[model samples]
Target chain A: MEHAVETTLTVNGIEVTRRIEPRRNLVDFLREELGLTGSHVGCEHGVCGACTVRVDGEIVRGCLMLAVQANGCKVETIEGLSDSGELARLQKAFHDRNALQCGFCTPAMLMAARDLQLKNPKASREEIRTHLSGNYCRCTGYQAIVDAIEDVLHG
Target chain B: MKAPSFAYAKPRSLEEAFDLLERPGAKILAGGQSLVPSLNMRLSSPELLVDITGISSLAGIQVGRTFRIGALVTHAQIERSAEIRKQVPLLAEAAAHIAHPAIRNRGTLGGSLALADPAAEYPACALALNATLVLLGRKGERRVPAGSFFKGLFETDLRTGELLAAVEFPRVERSAFLELARRQGDYAIIGLAGVADGSGRRIAFLGAGATPVLAKGASAASSLEQALKALGNDIDPPADLYHSSATKLHLAKVLLSRAWNTLSKPH
Candidate 1:
């Protein structure tokens, strides 16, 4: 039996194909095979949200989805989203607001907050908090993270 | 942690999926939110995974007198679905409390029920609505009430080769889902979903027992204290690390009182 599964998908606007083990998670695929290591893997069980990325425009846990499942799917990670200038406004706002500390959770936090921005432009503080509750930020305590997204929303 | 090696299969039709499931150590991979995590931790080591996403029949939402939610419907879909928000807001409200948005985007309704984690919100909501679960097997279709569906921890009435087709929920005159967790996205330590319609009122509790506790007519116990006191008989909760049996009971009563008090008020 062929242990490796062949998958073709668009990653950050680039179409790529690879043979990977059926169990290789999307995050590991991005990191090991593609060398796009922006997404962090924390609490691989899905609690920490450090591995959040966009699959077909919706944020999902990269560690929770296998690479073989990415066939024909469009994925947007921190590298691609950043390269595309999609996060310029949120990034600058995060920078100005000092929304990050230690920088471990920044990529995932920005990805998650940006998802809320695209979906709900005029979200309230509570809504932003609820949306961001998935991305764990131990350093900034989320005050700055929420403020960063709110800045992009209002500014 | 890396997942143990496993072969993968994509079944284009339910028939093909059923045949693949007949394999001794094969599992159905729906959203892979819970399963992937377990696989990574080596908690489960299935030899094969039959990915069901390609099965077109398993994905959709049909609204009628009762809503039919396809098994593959993601929690994020439920949270944002206009139909669910309009007809059965109970599901939408409960779906929002499940994990975070990233988790919701991939965690599916069928996967959640099939796994049947005691702390999950969907089971409680299903029980509160008196929803019927549709299961498909080689013999054909079978309908099981949500009350009797969950057998124990991570166990359901789903036979070895049966696939959960969809869940049917009746329209309710009023419904609400309330939960208490340490954080916004964490699983509820104690939660309650209460729904009422012409049929009657029912309250279901999560994190109360081996499965979601369906409290039939317990909300109509005259008073909140009376209802909670009566609920003790229905829920002999097993202790988990996060909450002891007494603590779970206490939280259940507090949440039930709060939910029942709201249900007590005329809608």
Candidate 2:
């Protein structure tokens, strides 16, 4: 079996190459190899959205995607979105609404919220709840998170 | 949890993919929404991971008299597609009931069908629509009717080295998809995907059995009351952790009633 596979992909805005085990998922690769720890690994499965990241302009569970599968793809983490100021308004809304508690699911929640904002800016409260359904925030009961996202969308 | 050690190969063509699949313990990797989770949980451990996403031919949607959706077409694509909404509205409706935006973004129709999860929407939708699955292998290509494609739980009739290429759904004028889940993105406890055409109605139920079951007895019934009564003869859904078998049957009847009403109404 081939233990190490060479993979090259653009993360955030920079291109990096590494020889990693095929079993290594995208989240672990980003956090361990590239030192981009903004994306959390809560479930290591696709259920929780804490490991959400944008690949080729679409948000996907980072833990479900292998690093080698992301080869030649443009990968964006929560760090990238924060650094690019793409999450500025959403961050502000979250700050104002106190959407986060313990800040475990905040990064992925923001990533998912920004996706909804870009795709459906005029999304209803129900739609917001539905869109963020995969992102489980045990704290805040999601009311404050929904309020924060609603503020960014329509407020 | 982490996936067990495995070799990965991204094949850009079907021939290369077939060659890789011929290797021992080779597993095809599609969207990996379900497979990756199983891999992390150590439920599935394949020695070789055959990454088939690089094959361009396996990803597209074509609509005409029949809607042909490639196996790799993601749920998000189906949900947002105007063409799908205007043509196969049932698919569009069912697509929204899938996990969520993130899972839909990565989960593919082929993966869902190939997995044959009784709680999934596509299998029931395919059975209701009488869709045809295009299977490609080393020798040639073959088409399997949706009725016989699903074998059992987490099982399909797809032969070894055969890949689900695309699904062809005949256009229908009236169709309805309804599911009752605990949460927005949770798997359906009981779901129905039904379509009415000139031949009659075809109703399929998910989470009713080991496979997506076509409710023949209820589908052939002329009236809603008869259909509701016939549902008992059609399915005997197994009990889950939360819901009783009797509760599931009741919920299935509820969905059938609503779908019957919707299909009976003129568009």
Candidate 3:
């Protein structure tokens, strides 16, 4: 079957139009089509938070959402967060706390942490643990990650 | 793995959407959290995907006689919905335990109810709350009570070409929810949703059997022990990698007792 849909989406405040395969997911489109690889694809089934990105105002797993579904929606990835100076404090906290080791999960971790910092600013350590539960770190850096997020929550 | 190639369409209106569903080998695509994964694994390869995101009319929260939630309302929306928190607190609590902050952001309420996963949170909560599912298809709109809607494991009363448009949760006086999972975001090994009225209580168990069902005669069990014993008789749990049927039934009783106490107590 051949399926192609022509649609335009505002990615990081830039409007781009493309005719792409219907099967292409948002993560693959961001990386392959737009060359925005900040969002990693860890679990294509949406278990891993590696492919997380803010759509409109909510974080969605990029691997599960098709690019076609993002048509006319605003997408904010880690690159956009950096460019827009949105992650300045969180980034510094991660670096200062050594929250990242291999850095494969850093971008998505930051994305997920940013959300926690805003929504549950007064969350306890356990709450922070639950918030970041979806994002996995092969390096087992839960303590540093939680500390970094806590630092920002209070910092 | 990437999903196999398939024809896709985004319908601007429900009429167009219903029309697309008539196409052979077409599947309705909602939040895509579940369907996309199945597609990527080639576990399901529909010839066409009828995307409903374009139908703006199919989203949002409406509070009237009952809590009418659009099928496209994401789990995150449910967690944050003040109306849901006030009216159906059990649903709000259940939504909080779905997957994670990100998955909850994209997983839809309608899709969860329609997929009818045995371990999912909504089915059990819906059963406990006596919620009604609104479906639309070529035959037009129909309302199926939650009790009869869920057929079996990962199955429902939803027919081919039928679209789960919304779910209506009846207003209840008191309710509480509980579940056991290996991890926070993992599927529950067993769960229960309990509701209380002036005299009696109703409890629904998830992952206790082929489907989320009432503890047989559990309504009459006035105490926790009775509720547990009633559940053992009601449910025939299936064994999986994580648990044996006996273990699941035992855990089901434990959780149901907790739910019973939680509901029986005053706030």
lDDT of each: 0.89, 0.93, 0.87
Per-residue lDDT over A1-155 for candidate 1, one digit per residue giving the tens place of the 0 to 100 score: 26898899999888999898998899999999999899998888888889999999999999999999999999999999999999999999989988888988999988988898889999999999988887877775699888888889987
What tier of docking accuracy does candidate 1 attain? high
Order the candidates by DockQ, highest first — what do you get? 1, 3, 2
Winner by lDDT between candidate 3 and candidate 2: 2
What residue runs in model 3 are displaced by over 4 Å at the alpha carbon? none
> How far is each candidate from the true structure, as Cα RMSD in Å?
1.5, 1.1, 1.5
**Per-residue lDDT of B252 in model 2:** 99
Tens digits of per-residue lDDT for model 1 on B1-267? 999999999999988998999998999999998999999999999999999999989999998878999999999899989889888889999998988988889889999998999899999999888899999999999999998899988889998899998999987757879998988978888889998765557888888878998875476577777787788887877777778889988888888867775577664
* Candidate 3: tens digits of C-alpha lDDT, residues A1-108: 257889799999899999988899999999999999999989798887899899997888999999988888998999999899989999999999999999989999
Query: After superposing candidate 2, which stretches have Cα over 4 Å from the reference?
Result: none
Q: Highest lDDT: which candidate?
A: 2
User: Which has the greatest TM-score?
Assistant: 2
TM-score of 2: 0.98
Q: For every candidate, give the share of true A-B contacts it also has.
A: 0.95, 0.85, 0.94
Question: What is the TM-score, restricted to chain A, for candidate 1?
Answer: 0.96
- Report residue A61 deviation for candidate 3 (angstroms): 0.6
On the 0 to 100 scale, the lDDT of residue A30 in model 1 is: 94
RMSD of 1: 1.5
lDDT for residue B102 in candidate 3, whole number 0-100: 85
